[model samples]
Target: MRRAAPLALLAALGAAPLAAQDSAPCGGDFGTFLQGVEAEAVASGIDPATASAFVAGLGPDPEVIAADRRQGVFQLDFLTFSRRLISQDRIDRGRAMADRHATTFDRIEAEYGVPRGVLLAFWAFETDYGAVQGDFGTLDALATLAHDCRRPELFRPQLVAAAELFAMGEIDHATTGAWAGEIGQVQMLPADILENGRDGDGDGRIDLKGSAPDALMSGGAMLQALGWRADEPWLVEVTVPDGLDWASTGLNHPRPVANWAAAGVAARDGALPGGGPGTGLEARLLLPQGRNGPAFLAYPNFDVYFEWNQSFVYVTTAAYFATRLMGAPIYLAGDPDPGLSGEQMIALQEKLVARGHDVGGVDGILGERTREAVQVEQQRLGLPADAWPTPALLGAL
Candidate 1:
């Protein structure tokens, strides 16, 4: 799910008032909690009447809490997640949307340095090109999460920002969106909308839900604000030679393109982009499913994907799908070694935690910290440090 822009950036955008609040006790009467939220919102510059009406009759949304607790879908492996999302229908529709909004796309690229594929890929994944933004009430979801004590510090400020949006007449208590409170076609949180939203349609109002240009442009602006390099390649499919040192392969180990090229990493279709000699572009070798599976050279631009979403599977899929939308050929999915099941992953994480390795949580998801710990364990076990957990690795541990 989407979060607000990074706190540093949010502060630069004058969002300090909302972020400065200390965490209060959670899990009490919903009405009393909302009263405090409303008072806090007004203190954070929300109009009094707006804050009152925004929280009027608001209660903790049980549906939001239930949805928050049910996120096992992220446990799917990279191939499974990418295959489920990057459908032929999505590709065709994405191209159609790009062509339909050529002028807006051109303007966004010229102004924000973000291509149509990047925006369209996110638009497709987020809401199927604005087809199915979530149905949860945005205000209720934010307020509920704010008072739920699970991640109150994160969601409480978002609730205040949504109240500020309500004050601006941008959204209302009935605004429906993702269960995490991300709204509109591109699924942005309220603070992000407030900071980076644009009126691309020239109607003087940023209507991300009703207007395609508005949503696409606002997404482009957000990416630019998140540090997208102009006219840079984010991900490139590549063929890796055997006997390569697998320990140095991951998003954490970025090497110069020339160095990687000299080491025998070749682009699948064309010559490796070495940033034209001495430009010093770097890339990290990424093997999402291990050395034998689909491989990529994820460049610096690809790092911006994490700022958009934290799920490695989702970000990699979105980056690769952006390449697909830009006319890259379908990737060759090679025979990869079997990965751990969700239960096995959880067990492995528990073991890692016992051994003083922080896997970020014992959730089934193979996040970056988990991957780092896995690589270390694989190295200690004299296995290939491809960072992909397998049955053998688990048995050894």
Candidate 2:
């Protein structure tokens, strides 16, 4: 799957490209910032009235800034995080929803090649199937983030896109959602709605909040646009043999299924998918925690999950939950070694950064890039190379 960065997302949507703003001022006078945002929205084809109204009384939201800063929940290990999220209640509800919207899901599969479980996983996680979309004022959240200077380059265009959406009457000042300015049941950014939103119920306008069909269809379409392959598996549980070359695992190393099978990697249940007839399918041996924890073979379709969300644990759990909803059995959680605490992780990241490795912001999350760096250092130190950092590795470094 192609990973669409912010600029790539704009290009794919045919939205007006934002000029480089690395040197642009942020957190200045709110009025002055709104003037520039309004001008950009107008240049991007939003009516001047709409843009002006969108930013007329907007002010920085302290709550939004706090939410952005306090994402410590993401620091949890995969097993703990997934255990909290993948409850029996959610699994049951997801299956019931799939049965309720069987026809719509079938149609989405036919049209977009995205399965019901994929959309349902996101729906269940994002807002509990639309039951609990946030209450932050959408425009206020966007404007606040756009002017906050922490991530102006990312949020500024989203604000303009929200303005354009307002002009199209898709959203209004009364619209509310996630603190990060994602709107509706699936919690989509404005650019995402403008780019991939679909009206599955044929109501003409896309209403993701009130319309389950619209949200599901729109989510499916977005996944398709993100390069979901038709009829491909995303993730499958597997058991890796002892003494396997752990350094050859992770998403960075995608070996053929035949190679993995030959290496004694067996599926937990049923026959493994062999990419039927002439398609050389490849998969990454993913050990989210360590060699001793639950393992999975992540396929190409799995990569699209990252495009949906950056958190490795969240994406893996979401993808695994999708599989469970599809009748897959529960995973086997082996006794993995205990992981480092948040502070230890920060110290490890500092050491890695000093050694010229980019762990992608060093926020103490074991993200993919961080895992890759860990594996490289593990191999260098003659450790297990499972990419699960421990106190020993930290002390050794």
Candidate 3:
């Protein structure tokens, strides 16, 4: 759910030769780089023998580097990505995994105060419960990104951490794969493995390779660190008034239920949950598909879910999947803005820019800023200011 910055996308687009050029700073000599990294690892408390063995004869993986360069295309509309990621197959697999690992999951939940269903949801979403944890070398991926000029400042430290992991004998050069240099069942980065990885199975090493216990426990620890509240719902379906002030609901904004109810918002069914009208738990009303699709009142824990992955669709899908694993219903409605396609969306951005609106960039993606601009344009055109982009709106522009 990591939201790539525009700079990251730009780097991805311009990566091939630039990545090669950036590697020159390390002198096009993998052996020297390995030696230097080993020296640093020893200085940072790694054993000399372990460092030597781990950093021996490693080279840049061109395949992994090329894959990094092509990550720009992975960005998709939130709902689209969610629908594919949280499919029925994944849900059924998660439920089965939950049942298979019931004892381990129960222990993790009791210890970490995270629900088993939520843990299973992350398990299913991240690496399919340890079934398909990519096939790239972690050291190669981190080193390539670190050597690349795009975000060396960010990835270099991770490279150092990857070296340290090697020195610890936690992972070898051969058995590692992750898009952003993460590894194992939960797709944890090297730094995360170093800091938060736990020996849940008590087998001496905290191996996320095939250990469900290690993966689930480590994921629970990460979520706990991100401020996940025990036993609190991340989000609940809600119904908003037809004439509600849609502009008031933005990311991180809070509105009490009393205030929302006064404005004619209500629970999707009949009544609110156990919490009082003014329970002091501030919530944000989100209309992801403008006002025409299903609505949700997101709680603080929902933001915690976002920390795991920044995409709204990702968090919502995780929450929804968790609910499903707990016997809750699927979403009552579908995406409202079904007409918007990538090319059409990009065209809309071009038209918006032509009209003197600064939409950040002419990317096809409709982020919060783009949605706001679309809303403004809709108002100016005497159309519904629901912020839902359409082909008709594009032609009119």
* Model 3, C-alpha of 178: deviation from truth (Å): 2.0
Q: How much does candidate 3 score in TM-score?
A: 0.81
Clashing pairs in 1: none
Worst 10 residues of 3 by lDDT: 3-12
Q: Model 3, 1-397: lDDT tens per residue? A: 3422112222222322211223233334556666777787788887888777766746667765555444333335445555656667777878888888888888877877788888887767666777667776777777766665555676667777876777666777786666567777777777777777988888877988778888878888888887888767777778777788776665545877667767877776556553475466767777667777767787778788767765445567677778777766666665576657767887898889888888666656566567778878887887766676777788778
How would the candidate models be sorted by lDDT, starting from the highest? 1, 2, 3
lDDT of 1 by residue, 157-215 (tens): 88888888988889987788888898888888899999999999999999998999999
The CA lDDT of each predicted structure is: 0.84, 0.83, 0.69
Candidate 1 vs candidate 3: which has greater TM-score? 1
lDDT of 2 by residue, 194-298 (tens): 999999899888998899999989899999998999999999999999989999999899999988988989899976787345669999999999999999999
Best by lDDT: 1
Estimate the overall C-alpha local distance difference test score of candidate 2.
0.83
